[model samples]
Structure formats: C-alpha cells, structure tokens
Target: MKYQVMHDSGPRLRVRAGQWAFTKEEGYGLASLLLDQDFIHDVFTSYRNGSILIYYDGEVENKQRIFDILDGITIDDLFEAEPTQTQVSKEITDDFYWNISGMIGRRLLGKWFLPMPIRNAITLYRAIKYIWNGLDSLTSFRVDVALLDGAAVTGALLQGQYDPASSMMFLLSISDELEHYTVQKAKSTLKDSLALNIDTVWLVDDDGEEKQVPAMDIDKGDRIKVRMGDVVPVDGKVVDGEGMVNEASMTGEPLAVHKTNGKTVHAGTVMEEGNIVVEVYSMNKETRLNKIIDLIENSEDLKAETQGKAERLADSIVPYSFLATALTYLITRNASKALSVLMVDFSCAIKLTTPLSVISAMREASDNRMMVKGGKFLEHYANADTIVFDKTGTLTNATPKVVDVIPMSRRYKRDEILRMAACIEEHFAHSIATSIVNQAAEEGLKHDEDHSEVEYIVAHGIVTEYDGKRAVIGSRHFLFDDEKIKLTKTQEKKIEKEATEHSVVYLAIDGKLEGLICIDDPVREEAKYVIEELKSLGIENVIMLTGDGESGAKAGAKSLGITQYRSQVLPEDKSRIVEELKAEGKTVIMVGDGINDSPALAAADVSVSMKHSSDIAREVADISLLSDDLYDLVTLRKLSVGMLDKINTNYRNILVFNGSLLVLGVMGLIQPATSSMLHNLSTMIFGAMSTKSVLSDRDISNDIEVEAIQVADAS
Candidate 1:
C-alpha cells in the first residue's frame, strides 16, 4: 500500500494511491482503519480517484506515524462489516430471551413439589432484595415510586401472603421489560426511516466517459451522470444537461422541479425526467436522518417544561403516599390496608408517560421529513406567537432566473456580458451567483476562465481582473457607491425601465458601466397558503425581512398578504429585529436559508432551516425541513401543539384514575393485591398509548380548512 501526497496544508492531508486506492469495500475498510487511530480526527475517501483526505489533531511529527500505518495496511487486514439492524436486533432479542427464561424458571420452581422450607427461603431472598432497595431510597432522602413498590412487596411477604408478593414482583419485572422494548422499537423505526440504500451509481470521468461504480466509490469533484428513475448519490452542482428532479426525500414536495445546468442538486433526490451530469461537492455529507437520531438520543436534557413539571409533581407525591400508608395502619390497625395504600402509587405513571409522548412526537416529525433537535424546540414552536422569515430561499424560490440582460455599451452583447459574468460567478455558491451562471449555460454561452483570482465581498459583489482589465459584478451600492462608477442619465432611465419588479445585478469593466442582469425571484407556490395556515394556528405576528429594496419587499408582501415587512436589512439588522421582537415578549420562530441568516436564526426562540440552506444557517437552526416547502412549518406547529395537548390529557387521566384507586385502597374497598394489579395495568396501557402517532388525516384536513376560513374572513 504505497501513497503519494496530493496535498498538505497544516493539519489536513490529501493522499492518493495510483489507481488502486478506493473500492466500495476497501474505502469503508480504510475509513474504519483510520478512524481507529488516535491521531486522526476525520477521514474521507474517494473511490473514483483512490484519494483520501485526512484531518488530524496532532503536530507535524504525527504525519510520519499516519504514513507508516497506511504503508503497513494489507488487503487481508481490512475489517469486515455487518448490517447495523442485524446487530441491534440480535442484542435486544438475546437480552429479552434471557429475561423471559428467568421469569419462566421462577414460575416453574414455585409450581414444582419443593420442600416448604426451601420454597420459603427462595421467597425470603427475593423479598429481602426489594426491602433493601426501599431502605436505600429512604436513606438517600428520596421518596420515589421504587420505595413504595418495594415496601408493598416486603409487607406482603412479612404478613405470610407469598402469592401476593410474588405476583407484585412478577408484574414489576414485566413492566420494566415492556418499557425497554417500547423504546428500542421506537429507535429502530427512526433509524429505518433515515437509512440511505444507495448501492451503485453512473460515474463520468474527465474524458466524458461514463461507467457504473459503487456509490461509496464516488468522490468529491467527480462527475456523476444520472438518468430518469435514478436517485442522485451526492450533493453537487449540475454542470451539463437538464432534468425534472423529484426531491420528495429532501423537500417533501410531490412535484418534480425543473433542474438544469448550474442548479444545485442534493443526495437522495430522484431524477424523474431527462439526464444530468453533476459535479459532486460533498461526498458522504451527514444525512438529516442521522442528525435527527442524534437529537432524539440526546434529548433527555432538552425536556419541555411540562415534562419537568410532571416529574417534579411525581416526586412531590411520594411523601404523601408514605404518610397515607402510615395513617392507614394507625387507624385500621391492619397491615393489608396500609399495604394497599402503598401499592397504588401515582408517581410511576406520571414520570413514564410524559417523556414517551415527547419521543413519539419526535419520531412522527422525522416521518414527515422534519428534524426537531429536542423536545424543548417543539415546546417553543407551539408557543411561538410571531414567525419571521428570510425573504430569499425561504418564502421565495431560491433559484431566481435571468429575465432581462441589459448591456450599456454597444461593444458588448447581452450574451457576451452574461458569459463573462457567469465565468466569474461560477467560483461562488450564492443563489444570485448560481442564477447568473445557470442562465448563461442555458443560452450555450461558454467562456473560459480569463480572469485573475476573484475577490468576494460578503453581501456586496465580486471583484476580479479579466483580460488585463478591472471587472466588477454586484449590487448598485458596490458598483456606483463603492467603486464610484457613474451612471449616465440615459443609462439610469434604461436601468429603471428594465428593473421593474426584478432584482438587478450591475456589471462594470475597466471603470466603465458594462450592463445589468435582471433576475426574477418568484414567491414559492405554497408560501401564501402556509402563512394563512400559521394564522389559523394562532401565530399573531407574521413578518418578512429582506436585503432587497423597499419597493421589492412591498410587492412581495402585498402578493403574500403579509402586512409587516422590513426592507434593506443587513445580516446584523435581522438579528436586531429578532431581539426587538423578543423584548416585546414574543416567542419568535425564525425561518431562513443562507449564511447571512445564521445570526437571526440563533437569536430566535426556535429556528428552522430549509433543505437547501447554507451550512452555517442549518448548523444554527433547531429544526431542519428536508424540503423547500413552507407548508411543513404549519405541519410542525400542529404536531407540537398536539404533543402538548396529548401530554396534558395523559396527566389529567393519570391523576383522576390513579387518585380514585388510592382513595378506594385507603377506604379498604379494594384488596391490596387487586389495587396493585389494577394500577400497574393502567400504567402499562397508557404508556403504550403515549407512543401513538400525533398526526391524523382528519386533523390535517380540519386544520387546513380552519386556516382557509380565517384567511377568507380577514380578506
């Protein structure tokens, strides 16, 4: 295994091994080997070119060690892989079977013709373990439900009621196992929902030759060709060809989008029509499903306030159960009555059901292509009164089109201007830049890289030297104000005439006004409907923020029926606006999809990012919508509200039913064994019910109609 250094820059190293580097099995094997080493921080392998990019945490001295390890690797030493589901199921099944066998053995021993002394000794040993657990809880000053369960079982044993004690312990063991099974089942479903099943892909090489290869072997910057019925294997930009892509996996949209050259495409999206050649940007990017799973697994710390209250209330009632048991003994002078009081504990049901309901709701969200980071985000979303949306790539379609290209100089043609602009814009990934470059490609305007290194000014424009002449393409402020390029009166009138209701990107070359490219960014089809739905869901303030001019914002707002809008907002201005809203005591849910929106996203009570959002924006957001549809926001709000409602309903039912049983036990109306059996039965029943799906067809229809009616009435 010999390798050549392809790139070396500080902690990051890129190494390639001739033509034998990456096979599907070998790539994963290599990644596994590198991940096992302490010096390596991350490893990304490309099967297309047999290249590996490694990021390490240690000093340059560790580089030699990494090379040594790579040199020592052989084909036979590669680790074998197993399906995750098989491993998970085997482990769970083994544990379950072991527990079932123990329970069966206990039952058989009791039924067999054993000596009375030996049988009594076995029963005593089990009772002593329960009593010790109860004593330990008391010593720690924690009056939990466990202490009550142990006390009831111990009391029954002490009173020579062996049957009742054995029954209590058996039911408890079953309850514990059932809880474990429920959680594992939920997790399994979630993992299956997020799994990517890609096996093979069509790879296009530098010479424009195509061949079939394993998906894992595809590398960043490799050209991959996809046809109708094929799922895109990586996130990339379309370099050539056109297609209608059904992005339901990412955006939840049922319709296919018309994607062409220069438009960005994502992994798992199906190409429904035509063909496309995509230049891969990220191979093995983190999937939304994996992120959601991480969130669900680590969400215990982010419990809703209601869930915390339920737990606190459960703990608070423990001492009351103990007091009632003592009083019952003093008044009735019967150990059975006191034991009944202890057996019907309320804390167990309250603590168990709340978290289960929250987790179930999260799983439901994942099914709907929404990833909620924690239970607390759901709570915030439900309570949000105001919703703020970034105008571009959120409410409007991110892929704007070039409608009119105006050239100032007779020396430059519209297509020539477009080709030059596209050549420079191809280096950047902004939505506007993408639109310019894509439009040029559609018109078959091919231009080579004739410019020097381009300098990108954030939120301003691009500066570069083309053909030994200074060239600039950006906003009016960047060209006229920053670069001091003057616009003639006649040129200004032409610009004004062409810029009606469209965003204009100015272009200048050699200190002279070259031309402008006017882009039309239409509002998303579902944007207005989503806004109406939010109103019906009780969102009080719906506002729009944009970096565009006041006229543009006003036109967008008027069309969408949004009354509150702020125009020409900078990155920091958006965050300030969110802060101001928060100061007004409004819970804000901000939706955005660009790097500029990251600050405002962080400032919101809860933030949502679109499927096509920039990395920084998504990283800061609490929720990520895998689709570009705004309707999912309404869907999410409904799910969150329904979850809170379900939790509250369970709480009420638990209190009423369990409180009644406790009262009946205290009055000696029910026997100790009967009370314990009924209480455990109800807890198990409700716990199972808590895992049910939150959304129903009827609920969705009703909510949609309600929103429509509200919008009509307001009109």
Candidate 2:
C-alpha cells in the first residue's frame, strides 16, 4: 500500500494513494482498519480520489507508526476488512442523495420532453399503486392516509386535471423516498450505537504466554484467552480449558452454558467461570454477535407510547377526512373543493413526523454515547416519576477501593488476611473482589494460588478451602445466617463502630469470624447533581436500592440527598419493589449494572446500565451508557422530554397549517392545485423539522454547569 502525504497539520493528516486506488468496499474497509489504530481518532477514505484524511493523536512516534502501518498494508488486508459506522453512514447518505436526484431528474425530463398524453399515461400508471393500496385498506375495513391520497389523485384524473394529478403523484413519490431514507439512515446510526465495542483482548502466543493486544490485531486462528467475568472478544471454538459461557446476549437465556474443548463460543458472551483459550475463527463484522446486533436494529421501530397513539389517531382521522370531503361536495356542489379537502388529510404528517422525531432523538442519544434500544424506552424514561438506583456501580465509583482490613483472629495478621482474601477473590471479577486484589498489590503482597477450587455464590460470597480449612467471604447474611459463622458480641460491636459507613465484606474460617474488610465505594462526583437535575425534570421519587449494609446504604443516600432507601435488599426484593411502585401508579426507571440487577431491570418501565457493567447487565438493560458518566442520565431525560415536546409541536403545526389549507380551498380562496401543493409541501417541511436535533447544540455538561451556577446565584 503505497501512499503520499498530501497535507499534515497538527493531528490532521491527509494523503492520496492515486486515482482508483481501491473500490468503495475497499475504501470502507480501509477506513475501518485505520480507525482501529490506537493513535487514530477518526478516518475518512475516498476511493474516487484515492484520498484518506486521518485525525489522530498528535505524537511523533504515533505519526511514524501510522506510516509504518500504511506501508505494511496489502490488498489481502482490504479483502478481509469490514465497513465501519462512518462507512455505513456514508453509503446510506450517498444512496439517498442519488435517489432524490434521480427522482427529480426523471420528473423534470418527462415534463420537458415527453408528450402530454405520455405524461398523463405515466401519471395514471403510478396512480394505480396508490389506488390499489387504498382499496386494500378499505377491503381490510381500514381507512388511512393512503385512501385519502388515492382519492385526491383519482378525483383530479376524473376531472381531466392531468397536470394536478401528475404533481400529486410526484409529491407522493418524494414522500415515500424521504420516509425510506429517514428510516434506513436511522437504523444505520443505531446499529453503530449498539455495536459491542471490544477495545483489546488477551492473546495467547505460540509458547502459551498471554499478552494484552488490540482486538483488531487478532487474525484467523489467533488464540485469545477469556477468563471468568470477561466478555469473549471473538467468535471461536474453545481449543483448551472450559467455562460457563453466558449466551444471554445471543439467545436471551438467563442460564450460562458450559463450554469445554472443541465447543464453539461467540463474541459478546461472558465467561461466568473457569478460563478458556479460544482459537479465533471470526471477529468484528463477521462474528455471530453482529447478527444479534442486526436483530436489535430491526427492533428500532418499537414505537413510543405517544408515537403509537399519534399513528392510531392518524388512521382514525381518515374517516373524518372522507366525511369532510363528502360534506364539502354536497354543500358547495364542487368536485374541486371536495378534492382539496381530500388532499390535506392529517394522517400523512402525523405518521411521518412522529417517527422521524423519535428516530432522530434516538440518533442524538447515540451521538452522545448512549444506546437507547428503542423509542418506547426513551418515552418511558421521560414519563417515569420514580427512579430506582443500584448503589454500587450506578451511584458510586465503579472501581471501589479497599479502605481497611481487620483481622479478628490473632492467628493471622492484617496483611495475612488481606493476602488470603486476595488469593481467593482474584478468581472472580466483581468490583469488591477487584478492590481486595488491588489492595494486596498496593501493600506489596503477592497472593499466590493457595486455595482449592473456589465457588462464587452470586450476590453472596465466595467459598473455598484454604490449608484444609473451610474459608468463606461475603455479605453478613451470607456468613452469619447462611454459613452459620458466629461472631462474638465484642467483634460485632467493633465492626459496627469501625465500618459503619463503608460496605463490609465478612470473612470466616471454619465457621468462625476471622476478619472484616471495609470497601469504600464513594458516590460519583456528579451523582447528587444528576439527582437534582432529575428532580427539576419532574421526577417525584428518587430511591436507592442496594444489598449493602443499612449504615452504608444510609450514608450513600444521605450523600446523594436521596430521602428513601432500602438496604440489605435481595434481587427478587428489588423487582418486587419496582412492581409495588408500579402498583402505586408510579412509572419506574431502574438503573443498575450487575447480574443481581437483571430481574429488577426487566421489571422496571425503563432500565439503564452503565459502561464497564457486567455483560449480562448490559444485555438486559433497556439503555446502556457507553461513557462512564452519571450525568448522561440527566442528558437522557432532557432528550426524552424534548422528543415528546417536539412531537406535540409537530402535531399541532400539522393540524393547524393543513386545516387552514382545507378551509381556504373550501371557501374558494385557493385553487385545488395550490391546496395540494401547500399540503404536501407543509408535510415535507414538518417531516424535515422532525429530524432536527431535539437537544440544543450546546454540550450537556457545560449547560448543566451553567444552569447550576445560575440556580446557586438565584438562591
């Protein structure tokens, strides 16, 4: 791959490879390939001009690396490459522009060069499809905008108004094309948003040494390692080792499937237990995970409650349109007036604008690094009055730190207890376990593999054998009640006094309390501000639900200014509470990021999961925040509310403007042709407006900060 640098300034680099350097597919491939580089932020490729524009991290080493990568590329690389989001979007946009241009060009050519008879014949031929659609709707005992449109065009043809009939058909064709383009473009954008982005993977070399490498660098037959709690990065067969792979993301099953050697596993699935070295067969665009994403993209039309209502209302209004047309003809004895009334039916604008607004709003959400699965979820989020938050990853820092470790037993020192805990906990992927392991590392303690096979009890504690003795570590209930690990009154009082505000992990050795580890999961910096914003946005109840101790839960709630909280709550209890809230007629939005949160997430009207969440949690969530920012919650709320407002505004404007056109035509103030033109023109205008961004161009964080300052000053 030979290329010349055409221009370079700071982080922007532009180069030309020469005319016809690659095909369109190759261009898309190149763009996706380039985008995978760590140094490159964005890339654009044009096959026609053989040009590439790369926006990259400005570093001298990075610049040299970019050139080195470009020089090593071969045609074989382009053949195996897959298109990026930008490429998909570019293709859709190009298709739309070409389609519109072709439609207009043909229409103009016919009017200028074709005979009047040919034009009328062409108009009549196009009118058949619309008439058939109208007749089909009527046969099915339904009246809709199609019937109205058909009637309007048919009436013009019958009255020998060939030019008006042609114009109506032309406008109708434009509407259809616009609707198709809007939907396709929206789906493309959403597919990009919902993509399962895996940045890096652990690659196993020939000698069996494992090293972290960029996911893109893995090729066919390259072995990659997947451990418990990590998402599998490629679609491959397990060549060595075994694990319980959670295929919930693909199959929607809650259970994890066991996979050993020779069994194939998919990307996007989570390894629940054990470890496996996978021989990669496919990745990126070719993986089975992409198939699931395609299915999700097809579900983009899961209409919002408001959107559904608007569509139903649009269809219901068709009978009234026919009724008005009939009344106009009978009263004025004028076919022109009746036809005008038919031309301006409300259903077209209503149906088109509502969906456009929804899809556009979803695109905006994706742009802001939030993946809203469907329009209905956004609606649910907006109308929700009550919100339930899972404290650990939602309200607090995702990476919790171990603040203290107390050894109750004189047989072991504090460091010894920490080392033993880290050795066992290192086998799991939970945040608390990570904290314990990190603490051991910070204290310069090496916790070797010292325990027997460890068993993880979800939402409880881990159990294993250490030195031929039963070792347990988990929640208070898991240890005291479940395991019958008795704690002396003095030790219990000591724990209460020392770890009151911090979440505590209890450790027991052979049914006796041995130590206590305090985990400091601090509240997010913007959490309180997000809660305040939610309240200002009309949320009535803000509640925290956690499995942490009562004292810890209370402390978290107090810090976030939340008045209500339920501590020591089980997963099932969380779901029950959400159900109870719904029973009270409160729309609930649940935010969580763990396996335990899955049930409650499903029970809520809308559920949001944060980035770096468990794979199962991400799969179950209605919306996923790609950025680790609680403030995205506030952005989501504002966007949803704005969507509803936009829909209403479009509805009102469509009705008023079209209604006026109808009245004017009926009162002999305008010709039927003028009315037809204005009606279609207004529908297109409103539709284009619907695709506009609901949220302002200003950054959400900056706006929130400004508003917060203003509020403080006002007080």
Q: What local distance difference test score does each model get?
A: 0.80, 0.86
lDDT string, candidate 1, 329-376, tens digits: 999898888888888778888878887788788878887888776678
Q: Write the per-residue lDDT of candidate 2 for residues 70-167, one digit (tens) a residue.
A: 99988778753566777678767877888899999999999899998899889889889988887887798777777888788888888888888788
Candidate 2: which pairs clash? none
The C-alpha TM-scores of every prediction are: 0.70, 0.86
Q: List the residue pairs that clash in candidate 1.
A: 250-626, 251-627
**Over 4 Å off, model 1:** 1-123, 178-300, 408-413, 477-497, 511-513, 699-715
Q: Candidate 2 regions off by >4 Å?
A: 1-22, 29-81, 105-132, 135-142, 199-225, 233-245, 251-267, 276-292, 295-301, 426-429, 438-450, 697-699, 702-715
Task: State, as a TM-score between 0 and 1, how close model 2 is to the true structure.
Answer: 0.86
Q: In terms of TM-score, how similar is model 1 to the real structure?
A: 0.70
Give lDDT: candidate 1, residue 273: 57
